[model samples]
Structures are given as structure tokens and as C-alpha cells.
Target: MSRPAGPAPLLRRILQRGACAALVSGLLLVRQGRRDACSGAAPLNAISHWLWPESALRQCGLSARYTLVGAIIHWGASCFWSAIYEGHRQAGAPPPRARPPSRRPPAPASEVPSHDLVNALALSAIAAWVDLVLVPPRLSPGFERHLSDASLCRVYLAFGIGLAWGGARGRRAHRLPPGTRQLHVES
Candidate 1:
């Protein structure tokens, strides 16, 4: 048996993990919201309630405007983290050993897997559904509330941190061999 070449395996694993993470996160948020509601806590808001689904967004002090703001924050964070990871990988090793001098170079190590675009979009949709469709129906009338702006900002920060951490891990795992000369040979 022989290992396959290129990034097919790596891509598959990333997609699998991304999907699993999104599913697990969604389920946990739903469960927490239900538990909090049952305990008489305020219900979380539709757009800004990832960490504590049971708590009302109103209590957190966020406005409806923060929803769009948070989305923008998330997108920027993802891009930033992805770039950092790719940069790190590029810096880690020598160029691949074998190559046509005129050929284009491979992508940087920190680059997000192309498959991740789909995963990111799917995860975003899942998050929206959890916040909007699922949480609202389960919330009691008294639970509907908005989060504080500060609290929403904090959540965005945490989300950014998570993305950075995941990007770093991916970059570390996918390091291509350094030294272009070492990678290929003229037969």
C-alpha cells in the first residue's frame, strides 16, 4: 500500500472536523438555552447568543445593530487568522526541492484549505439557525431580550481567538517540506 500524493486526505479531514465542530456547537447551544429557560433565566437574543443561550440578549445589553457588526467582525477575524497561519507556514521551511523553475509556487502553509470556504458558510448558516429559528421558538415571552454591546464584543473576541487557534493548528499540521531541491528530482 502507498500513501496518496497531494492534499486530498488533509482536505477531507478538515472538512470532517469542521462539520463535526459546527454540529456539536449547535447542539450544545440549544441544550444550554433549554436548560436556562427551564431554570427561569432570561432567554438569549437571536443574533448574539452563542456562549450562553439561556441568558437574554437584553440583559447582556446588545442592540440589533450588533448582529451585522458581529458578522463583519467574524469575517475579518477569519481572514486575519487564515493569513497568519499561512504566513507562519511559509516562514517555517525551505522551498520544495523539485519544481519546474517556471512553474508557479505552491500556496503558503497558513492558507485556509479551499474546502473550508464551504465549511465556513455552512457553519455560519447553522449558527444563524440556532440563534434565530431554534432559540426563538423555545424561549418564553419573558425571555426575549437583547445583549449588552460590551458583552457582544466580548463574544466576538472569543470567536476570533478560537479561529486563530484553529488556524494555527492547521498551519502546524500541514507544513510542506522545505527546500525546493529536496522535493523533486530529474529522473
Candidate 2:
């Protein structure tokens, strides 16, 4: 008789595809929004300044170059945190025993829930939005001419690319035998 495919593997594949889609779509939308915002004269320069206060430190304060650096830094940090969280989940291990006589209990399902890659990607996208739409604006010039929609879109795109890269790495790691299975001791 032919064997049935395991649900776990199927789920993993689905999750991976979802993650890729979310990362791409979220980024594109953010970029488009940024572009639309920057095309006007009373340019949202305040928003740009707010998103990148560090640019204010430059002698020629608020140049595109300096703002770009800030955007890159922001996106980079968001990607780093998402990857770190996903890595932790992927590499987590069950409790271990130190003695031959030890009787360990099986881990509860709640404690060993399957992680969905799509969820991770979605969260990463949310983080990117928070950084660009809320955090930067509140902390910086609050709506400068440079804070054009285009600039914000580029920032989101960078964040999305980072998230996609991390997700790909995580998917590969998930495919490894070590990452796919978990061990637990039972009494």
C-alpha cells in the first residue's frame, strides 16, 4: 500500500509559501504609499525628518544620503529581531535528562506548538510598518519634506527584503532533520 504524506511537511510547505507572499506584498504596498506621498510640493519633508533624525546630525543636515542611511538602519534592525525570534523558535530543544533513573514527563502540546513561517513573516512586516509609519514619525521631525511616500516605501521594501532573506534561511534550517523533529522523555 502507498504511504500517506505527513501533515507536518505539508503544513511547512504551505507556511513557507505564505511567508514569501506576505513579505513581498507588504513591502510593495509600503513602497507605493511612500511614492504617492512624495509627489507633492508641500512635501511631507517633516515626516522624512522625523523618520531620520540622525540625518539632522550631518553638516548638510537632511540630505537624501543621510536619510537613506537612517532608513537602512531601521530596516536592518527590524529584520535582525525577526530573524532572532524565528531562530530561537527553530532551534529550541526539549528538556534533557541527566541521570539514568530520571523519569521525565512528555512535553505538553501547548509547550511544543508548531510554528508557522507565515506568522513570522507577517509579524516581521508589522514590525517594519511600526518602525516606518509610527515610530519614525513620532520621534523625528514629524512630517518633513523628505518624509515622502516614496522614501517610506523604499524603507519598507528594504525591510521586506530583509524579512524574505531571513525567512528563506529559516525555511532551509527547518528542512534539516535536526530542525524538523523534537525529542522528549517519558516516564
Candidate 3:
């Protein structure tokens, strides 16, 4: 099936991966927090613990204020990174070939570019650096407060994997299918 060639489809694809990346990374943060922190999801809640600075040091729960705010922040970052990745992929992608679909079935998620993982990982690494080193401590995700350096690396890795897996759900989107893209596209 031919997809409409325009900004609309492109935007949808980026959003799909963004939402997925946010979720995957957030979940891992929660899991790691539970394993290593005083409570569950503290790292996630710590993301927006600015209002309650002590939350990063001692508090750890699913409170709406901390968890909700943190989640939004994470989601926004994921989407932003996904957009950057999509744009880079678009710039480098070869023009579509004239031949019909090959005998081989579509790799799976036709909506997602075939070669994105490396780009996604590289982008995630940059994101991690910006978050940890450039962003002021108060504005940071607060993950480091609750996790070891090793665990922190895992969370970043999860973010990269999440960006890649976001579109892995299916290619039914764009044309509009019920999947991760549904979170980003109006179907």
C-alpha cells in the first residue's frame, strides 16, 4: 500500500517512536528504582521532584504530582529525540525505488525506517549526556539520585531500545492501525 507522501505521515512516524521510547525508558526506571532504591518508581517520581526536592533523596511513590509531572517530561524528551532521529533518517534515506514490492515480505513495520537503531542509540547517548551533564541538577530527570552508575546506563540503553521497538509493533499505522502509533496519530 502506498502511503501519502507529505509532512503528515512523517510526523506520525516520529511521534510513534517517541511515545514508545518514553514508555520503555520510564518503565525501566521504575523497575530499577524498585530494585535499588527505598521504594518503587522513585526514579520516575524523582524526575519532577523539583517541587519536593526531598523526594529525590527519600520519597518514592506513585504520587500524581511527582509521577505525572515526571512522566510528561520523559514523554516530551522521548518525542523530541524521536523527531530528531526521524529527520536524520529522512535526510539520508535513498529515494524510493521504482520496482514493485520484492518477493520478500515487508520487514515488519514498514512505517519505521529499516536502519534506525544505530541512529537512535547515538541520539540517546547524546540525550543522556545532556541530561546528566548539561542540564542543571534541579532540572535533571533525578534518576542518578536513586540509581547506581551501572543501573543508570541500563536505563539509557532501555531508552534506545524503546525508540527502536516503538515502531516494531506493526506497520498498520499511518493508514491507521490500533497500536503504539495510535498514541500519537488520530485514527
Candidates in descending lDDT order: 3, 2, 1
Give the distance in Å from residue 36's predicted Cα in candidate 1 to where it truly belongs: 18
Q: Arrange candidates, best TM-score first.
A: 3, 2, 1
lDDT of 2: 0.44
20-135: candidate 2 lDDT, tens digit per residue: 43355335433443554442221222334444454433223234554444444433444445545545555674533355743775343323122444445455567656555676
Identify the runs in model 1 with alpha carbons over 4 angstroms from their true place.
Answer: 1-102, 113-122, 135-172, 178-187
TM-scores for all candidates: the values are 0.30, 0.36, 0.79
In terms of TM-score, how similar is model 3 to the real structure?
0.79
Give candidate 2 regions above 4 Å deviation.
1-30, 33-35, 39-64, 87-116, 125-137, 140-165, 169-187
**Which candidate gets the maximum TM-score versus the true structure?**
3
lDDT tens readout by residue for model 1, 65-131:
4333333333433344344433444466486565455566656666656554444444444443444
Clashes of 2: 19
Candidate 3, poorest ten consecutive residues by summed lDDT: 177-186
| Alpha-carbon RMSD, each predicted model | 13.2, 12.8, 4.7
Model 3 misplaced stretches (Cα beyond 4 Å): 1-3, 50-58, 96-98, 108-114, 170-187
lDDT winner: 3
